[model samples]
Target chain A: MLKRYLLSPGPTPVPEKVLLDMAMPMIHHRTSEFSNIFKEVREGLKPIFGTRQDVLILAGSGTAAMEAAVVNTLNEGDKVLVVNAGKFGKRWVEIATTYGLDVITIDIEWGRSVKPDQVESKLIAHPEIKAVLVQASETSTTAYHPIEEIGKIVSLRDETLLIVDGITSVGVYETKMDEWGIDILITGSQKAFMLPPGLALIALSEKAWKFTEKSRIPKFYLNLKKERKSQLENTTSWTPAVSLIIGLKSVLEIMNKEGLPNVYKRHALCAEATRKGLMAMGFELLAKDIPSNSATGIVLPEGFDGGKFVKLMREKAGLTFAGGQDHLKGKILRVSHLGYHDFFDTIIALSSLEIGFSQFGLKVELGAGVKVAEEIFKNHLGV
Target chain B: MLKRYLLSPGPTPVPEKVLLDMAMPMIHHRTSEFSNIFKEVREGLKPIFGTRQDVLILAGSGTAAMEAAVVNTLNEGDKVLVVNAGKFGKRWVEIATTYGLDVITIDIEWGRSVKPDQVESKLIAHPEIKAVLVQASETSTTAYHPIEEIGKIVSLRDETLLIVDGITSVGVYETKMDEWGIDILITGSQKAFMLPPGLALIALSEKAWKFTEKSRIPKFYLNLKKERKSQLENTTSWTPAVSLIIGLKSVLEIMNKEGLPNVYKRHALCAEATRKGLMAMGFELLAKDIPSNSATGIVLPEGFDGGKFVKLMREKAGLTFAGGQDHLKGKILRVSHLGYHDFFDTIIALSSLEIGFSQFGLKVELGAGVKVAEEIFKNHLGV
Candidate 1:
């Protein structure tokens, strides 16, 4: 019997401790017992988001929270600037246009991050734009954008709000939402939170809260204003993802015991080792500049079938890695370093890649990649 | 240590087998393994919903599906008739009004079900009503509506649809959606599904599909048409609650093994035993006419302090029961037999209620309520 491992960008491996904690008998959410847990989990999320504002927990996927961010702060016909860098960036445009917002995009190549100057120039060109939408890390391309720099560019304009989708970045790296002038920040539970999907955490600045007063988007389930009132009282506006919230409390405790700084450092080491090991094996990365610490996208060698490779890895080796989407399909493979992953996981990924390349008729030295990864881990012993 | 028991209607206790199944390591959603499970779960939900139509699984609470039922079928400025019998029934009116629908509600008392004749007359008077929104079992008041009779009336008109919120009744009772001509049916995972409160299941009729083509409500997250296309291919449009869906598969298996009819009989037996036991103890039921088989609502004696009774049962005796909402607050108590429940659970509830009564300074004959419950159980041995 072959054991299975999940190495995808999202739906990463959940810790056994967290899983067993969630497996306990269900409790009523309205009771004071659950209220205490909710209060702690809500407070625990703020430091990771780097915010002082109340973080609203929603009972949907990351996309639902992304939709909430757009509908709750903007009205029909409101002009907005979207940074179209990858799949998730394009999502912001789709959500904005669906709500009747006139969108002006700062388009960039799929693997590269948008320049801060480009956003500033777009704001200058369209002063009527009411918001600048972007991503902290694009999961599709494995690229990390300069959110702090972009936050500065948008902060100069009082009328424009800065909205950042930090789904893959919040707990993986440092994202100071308040200090960086980010008006709104969002993340999902399946990413760095080391849990299953279904819950999304979002926070809004004082400035973003002011926009809701004048916004005219009609909503009920995703209404942030109503949710804030309930959340402040240690409850959710709707029936929350209760089991996930309980799992969240345990994960936060785990993260707290390890210290957030060390958590970020561990992710950094895993990502760096994977990237360095792949480079040593003569493979190129999709994200040439500013690679994200959450996941690493590798450019498959010529004549290699990525679809077949991923399928074989999953079915034969019982290892799950993500293949590319859209145009990058059959050309790239993405392996995640986010959420409950460590150095050994990185070593296993590199060793498998070495074997996969050999099976695909490519020349590869045995243990070449793993040796480099081992050296990196050995150098950073504490991490 | 006090062993806590959850007897609430919504967040009911999940079976240990289902909980353990969910505790297994997480898997990627974009794989054949997950797709196969999803396809099976979707197909499994059809027999329970009693519909041949494709049932869509959403990753939010019950209210999200209620909103989806509205935004997908009817457009802005549409008029709808809502049966406002209890708290959840009032929710339909609130959701419809939030999305610009002109709501005309047939207001009824808290514990009484809406009359089918009244609904027929309302539809006859207002032919412009796009839909008749209602609930199969009102959890707040423990009342069950006559959905089949109302469905027959609504089916006679091709222009109007009948939407039923079966959050507490679908698996607890036999709801033949296709036979009864229900256009849209909705339920949550936490209630009769014996899981947590993250996933909502919805199914739409062929006639309801036609309504979506002409509807013009702006939506993105709760877009049912987009979700239907993806769900047909054994996937979801957004990230689903993977763990809860896995738990649903196990619970459905348990139900299938017992047979759906037997499951319904179990719920009916538990509900009847609860009602009879409370009646034997001289407590009046809130639902005087047609009480739901999901839960039993009891009216406390004069100056009995229902809130204090419920609190003591929870804190002191480790038994959790729901207090009355709205006007019934501090005057009634609700105990559930919705999912993963049996006759013993009813006996425990009755025994505790008897103890709580005496502790709260009301004279209660010990073993009086439990004896009637035991007699009922003995009479229906196979169930």
Candidate 2:
């Protein structure tokens, strides 16, 4: 029997402890018992979010929270700047346009992060732009954009807000929201939280609250103001995905044990190992400059189909990796080391890649990547 | 340790098997293994929905599916009739109105269901009503509408479609979607599904598919055509709530073992016992004519606080019941006998109500209601 291994960018493996905790008897969300747990989980999210503000939980995916951020903070005719670098980055543009926003899309080339100067120029060109929407870590390209620099640039504008989709970034890297002047930060449960998708976590600063007060967009299920009011009372505005939040509490407890610095460092090590492993196999990364410490995107070698390679890995080796989305489709494969992953998982991922490449009739030595991953683990013992 | 029990109308207790299955391990949604499982789950949902049509799985709550039904089935500014009986029914009006539907509300009183003849009369008067939005079971009042008769009336009109909020109904009662000519039927993973709230299951008929083709409402995340196409390929369009769908498969398997008729019988027995138990304690039901067979709503006795009674049940005894919403708040307590509950649970719920009332100085006879529940169980067993 082939052992199954998941290396997808979003649904990274869940820890057994968290899983078992979620498996216990379900508790009603309105109870004092659940309210206390919700309170603890919210309080614990502060360091991971790097914010003093409330990190509210939603019952839907990160996309829902993305919609919530837009519709709750902007009016119908307001102008907004979207940094479109990858599939997720393009989502912001779509959501903005759907809400009748006058969108000024700063389309960053696929697989490339936007330079802070590019965004500043666009904002200067369109002073009416109310918010600058971007991805902290573009999942489609495994590119970590310089959100810190963008935050600094956007903060210079009195009326502009910086909204970051940190779906795969938070808990994997540093996103000091309060200090960086980031107005809205969003994340999903399936990434660094080591839980399944269903819960979207978003935190808003006092500056963002100011935007909500004047926003004229219509919203019901995704009104962050309503959700925030409910969250302050240690509850959700509506009936939440109760089991997922229980799992979230368990995951946050585990994150608390590791601490923020160590948690980010662990992700950095795993991602570094995976990237080095793929590069040692003579494979190029899809990211143009800097790579994310959450997932590694490897460009398919000549004559290799990214989709076929990923499918073959899953079918033959029981290894699951994510293929590219949108413009990058059939050209890149993304392997995540975000949560419940270690240096050893990088080795297994590399080994599967090596075996998969050889099976596809490409002349490459098997274990070359695995050896690199092993050495990185040995060298980073202290880290 | 007191025995903890969840008797809330929405987040009814999760069956251990389903919870454990969800907690087992995380699987990547793109993998063939997961796709195969998704296909099986989709096919299995037909019998549960009482339809031969495809049942689509969504990653959000029932409200999302309700929104999907509205935004996908009708164009903006299309005239629609909403049956506003309780909180959830009013949700349809809110969603339809938010999406720019010209809403005509058929207002049902707080604790009553809509009459089919009245709906027919309204339809005859306003043939321009393109859709009728409603709930199969109004959770706020525990009132079950005559969905079968309403469906029959709406089906006679070529231009009109019936959209149902079966959130707390489908698995609790047999929703014969195909036979009753239901255009759109929706339900959630919680309630009678024996799982937590995260996934929403919706089925659409052929006429509803026709509506989606010409609908002009904007939708990105809740796009059914995209979701349906992906499901046919044995996957989801977006990153679905993978763990919850896995749990749904497990619950469906258990339901299959019990058979739909038997499952309905179980819910009927539990709900009947709950109603009789409360009635025996001289408690009045909120529903005027017919109460939902899923949850029983008991009106507050003279000088009794519904909130205090429920709170005392949770704190003193480990029992959880649902209080009212909107205008009915602090006036009614909903005792649910949905899935994952049995006759013994009905006894516990009544005992808690009795004990909670006595402890709150309401002067109710303890064990009087539980005695009726015990008798119901014994007589049903043919003992």
Candidate 3:
């Protein structure tokens, strides 16, 4: 039987060590041992989030944290600017509007980054805007938004909190929340944490914390203030996903041992290899100039269904690649090299893609993509 | 060093097989393999929940599912009869009120079960009440509400939907969702499922589905309609906690092999043995006559601090027990004999508790509790 591989952008491959760590016998969350582990995880996440403030852990996906950030910080009818460049970017608008916020969307084209000027103009035009929401890396379209520039502008403005969805970027990219003036940074365990999805991690700056104080939008389970108060004593406000927290601690330990710089470099190397390999296989990139290091979106050749291609890769080659979402479906295939993936995984993915495309009646050179990926790996590894 | 044990009501000790199952390599959610596993899980949950309706899974705690049940079935200004028997019961009211629902509380004492007559009277008095919310087993006070009676009453009324929080009781107690006329039965992975606390599982009946048509509450992530649409195809509306789902699948498999009837019997036997042992040790039961088979709530002996006693059991005996929440704090210690626990675990817990209580200056005969627990286990096991 062929070995199955998960190459999806969000639920990336978990490290063997993290899996082993999670396999340990469950510990009581109320006990000191669990508290000690939680303390280490909370402190460990601080440097990774690039913030000194408390990081809130929720037993939900990244979307829950996003909802929490909105409900806890923005009041009903509060004006907010949402930078919509992709599916995830649009989700911010959807959630904000659902919470009865006055949402002003800065509509950037799909597969393109949110320009700093567009964000600045939106903020300038709407002085009543209490918050600006954007995605650091839009997983749906593989677009890396200009978060630092957006954060800087929002930071200079009074009362406008900069909320960033760092789901696909936190561990793979440099998301310096405090340094970049991002008021709220949200990520999940699945993406770059090298763990299976269960926990949503979020860090809020003083500015965002202040916004939470007067926010009237009602919330219960995802209340940031209650979570923060409990987390101060190294405990979750409610029952946490204990096994996932253990997995997170193990992944953070690995990340700490490798160092953030090395982790970022590794992701960049994988992204470079995947892009080079796909380009060598005569594939056109969807997000051309500002592609995300988290995932590489490839436009299928004319007459080839990207969704069918993804299915073929999974069924024939045992490679599970992500198909595009919304409008991008059947047009592009997303190849993720984030989290526990490395050069070898990239080679396998490219090889699988080669087989899939060829089998699907699209002409593609066999081993051409793998060879390019190998060359890139060799260059990076100095072999 | 002695191995640690979890005695918390939720986030119970995960079965080793469940952890191992979750540790398996991640699979893409959209793939056939995942869909197959998800389908099996959904089917398995039906027997456990005793519901024929579709069971939707969400990546959050039990509260998320509770929120989903409310937001999906109740509209703004909807009158909901909330039976506040414990912390979780009050939570239903809190969440409903947060969503702008007019909530009428059937306030029962913390350690007492909600009376069926109280619910019936409230519903009769408030003809506008559209929903009746209560917990099957309130984890906070270890009281099992009379859900069957409440269900029967709610079923008699055409417009009032019965929503039961089966989080701590689903797998531990005998829950017949369809037979008992429970419109919406909600549970969490951590409690009776014997997995981590990330996945919230909810099953809705035709009545609940009809109520959803008129629900006007704003919801995104916890929207049951969206979840049902995706779940019919064995997929989630959003990113799922893949590992937790895998763990849940394994747990359900274990439950299937053991059989749900046998699982419930085992939990009942364990709870009986634990309660008998604590009683033999001269400890008073906090929940009194009507108690949850999920956990045994024991009142600390006079002058004994519940927190310190729990700490001693955890630190010195390497046994972790749950201290009571809120009003019961420092007054009661809860010993959970819920999912994944057995006869031997009960014996160990009783022995540890006896030793811890004696060490903390409580008057207790050495080995007395253990003897009682052993006798009960022996009788149940036919040894």
Candidate 4:
């Protein structure tokens, strides 16, 4: 009998506890009971965001918060620097361009980490740059850019703000928001937060709030300035995703019990094992430099059809992993080790990969990959 | 011991079955399973919206879809007629103004509906007006506007689109999107859909879609044209509220079983009973001209203390109803008879209202309201 496993970077498996917490009868969002819960959620999120600033919880996907970050921080025709390394980085360029911003895009290679020196050069070239938009860990490519270095560069510029897409990064790694001087950071519920994907969590620095006050973009639902005002009163500006927020409270409590550092270490161990295991299976690692602990991308071997392989995994073993996007489609696979996952899941994924290879007539290493993973797990400090 | 009941106008109680559907094991949104369900939801919403056009589901509160309707169908500096009747109507003005629309507002009384003649006169004076925004039922005042008549007027103008906020109206009343020539219509999950408040359902006519193409508003997340393109491929432009969408599938099935006509009749019967019941207890209704079937707004008697009465209901009887907003605060109370509610619920609400009245040191006729509601239920098609 085969067991079903969810390994998608997005919509990661939610803890059953969080699911049950959300499943309980929903209370009115306008009530004091919910307000207290929301207030707690707001405060709870600050530690994870590594900020003392108020974090805004929105009733939409992560893209909604990303859009909120863009439209609420820059005015029309404002210039910005966007690092386009992967899918989400491209999204930053897209959103900025869509909002009539003059974007100076630094097009880095896919699956490659962006150099902060490149941003420094571009910012130097564009004196009017209002913001630097990038992802902490690009989910599509599993590449972690040096956001700390980028934050250092942006912090030196009085006119420029740093906005990080922490969708798959926050709980998976130590995203030192306040420490690194990140002006705006965004995350989603379904990632390392271990909840459903409806709620978008956003945190802004005091500088970002100032930019929000000056931003002239037309917004009603995603107006963070207004949201900030209502949040100060222990309520949301609009009706939030009540069930998801309740789930967030419970999930945050779980993370608190596990502790943020331990959560990061757990995800790191799982991701490292997965990456090492894939390499042992004769698969090429997608991100050669600074691979993310959030998810691991693998380049399929020559003559091994990726689309057919993924379809086979799902049909044969009930295993679902994300396939490549854009130009890399049918050439790579991504296994998510983020959120509510551990070494056991990594072993299962490796076993599933081996089964997929043998079924496709590719050379089978048997448990060679799992053995590599086992060695790493046994030797890992925390484990 | 008192049983808890949810009677808020927006976040009406979710059916236990629907909640269970949401609580079931979460599924990947990118898979065929979720796509099939989304397709079903798309088709199911068309009838309730009274249109053949595909309704786009957004992962946000109804206000997000309202902003989408405004931003996706109009350009900057476009003249529009806003019917400022109540809170929701005022929202139309706020969104339009936020997007830099040249708004010609028809300011009506808080509890009143817009007169089409006034709109017609305004349209005649302002020939450049591109759209007219109004609500089917204003939740705050519990008043139903003359959307049918307004639709007739807007339909005559080829340059102007009719946008209706059906958040509290769609399943509660006959919106008639196609029959009445509504160019845009929107609804929320927590209202007539009998689900949590995360999914916003929006539909656009061919004309509205055309407007969407030409709309010059700076938008990224609320872009409907992008959403429509992706929806054609059986997916959303972004990750949606998957659990709520799953719950939506079940709730829509329940709604289909009840039938739109029967649902409307049920809401009508309940609202009529509630209004009559309140009046029987010597309390006057706030909505004098056109009371809505979705909810009932009652005017507190002089020196009766509406706030104290609502608080008493919650404390002593475990009942929750909506207090007034803005100018109506502490003057009126709103009782919702929207989705997942029945005649028995109406009786319970009436009994709770009577209990609250007596507890607040106001003269009560004991079972006067419930008796009236019970009599109406007995005479209705089914008790």
Stretches of model 2 off by over 4 angstroms after superposition: A365-367, B362-367, B379-383
* Tens digits of per-residue lDDT for model 4, B1-383: 76789987978888888888888776788888789998998888888888888899999999999999998889888999888888888899999999888888988888887677998999899888899998989998998888998888889888999999999999999768998989999999998888888999899998898888788887888889999989877799899899999999999899889888989899999999999999999887888789999999988877767777667676666788989898888889899999998988899888888887787778999999988888888977452
- Model 3 is docked with a DockQ of 0.73
True contacts kept of each: 0.92, 0.70, 0.76, 0.73
- Worst 10-residue lDDT window for candidate 2 chain B reads B374-383
Candidate 2, residues B125-221: lDDT per residue as tens digits?
8899999998998989999999999999999988999998898889888779989989999998888898888888899999999999998776777
Q: What is the Cα-based lDDT of residue A124 in candidate 3?
A: 78
List TM-scores of chain B, every candidate: 0.98, 0.98, 0.98, 0.97
Q: Candidate 2 or 3, higher TM-score?
A: 3
Model 1, B9-29: lDDT tens digits are 989999999999999999998
The best-first sequence of candidates by lDDT reads: 1, 4, 2, 3
Candidates 3 and 4 compared: the better one by lDDT is: 4
Compared with the true structure, what per-residue lDDT tens digits does model 2 show for residues A1-383?
98888899878899999899888888888888989999999998888899999999988888888988998899888999999888888889888888789888888777788899999999888898899999999998999899999999998887999999999999899769989989999999999999998898999889899999998776767878988999999988777898888888899888888777888988988888888888888888888877999999988876668788788788887888899887678888899988888877888888877887888887678889888888878867766
DockQ for all models, in order?
A: 0.92, 0.68, 0.73, 0.78
Give model 1's TM-score versus the native structure: 0.99
lDDT, candidate 4, A353-377, per-residue tens:
8877887898979898999999888
Of 2 and 4, the candidate ahead on lDDT is 4
Error of 2 at A234 (Å): 1.7
